[model samples]
Target: MVTLGQLTKKVEFLEKRVKQIMKMLQMVPIVAPWEWES
Candidate 1:
């Protein structure tokens, strides 16, 4: 029995995690630009 507020918080937490993952992904390309240079 999840309440609406709890569900919203869970969604927000997932969104933050996704954004963190995106930032990590964004960093990998910058750190290893040689992969995409070709």
Candidate 2:
């Protein structure tokens, strides 16, 4: 039985992690977009 508060906290934590991952994801493209240009 997950409470609303607990669900909210989990969602927030996941959102934060996703944002961090997105920032990291951007680096790969910026660093090597040319790798796939061929």
Per-candidate Cα RMSD to the true structure, in Å, reads 4.2, 3.3
> Candidate 2: which stretches are off by over 4 Å?
30-38
In order, what lDDT does every prediction score? 0.90, 0.90
| Clashes per model (N, Cα, C within 3 A) | 0, 0
Worst 10 residues of 2 by lDDT: 28-37
Model 2, global lDDT? 0.90
Off by over 4 Å in 1: 30-38
Q: Could you tell me every candidate's TM-score relative to the true structure?
A: 0.73, 0.73
Q: Write the per-residue lDDT of candidate 1 for residues 6-37, one digit (tens) a residue.
A: 99999999999999999998888465557766
List the lowest-lDDT window of 10 residues for candidate 1.
29-38
Candidate 2 per-residue lDDT, tens place, 1-38, comes to 99999999999999999999999988875656677777
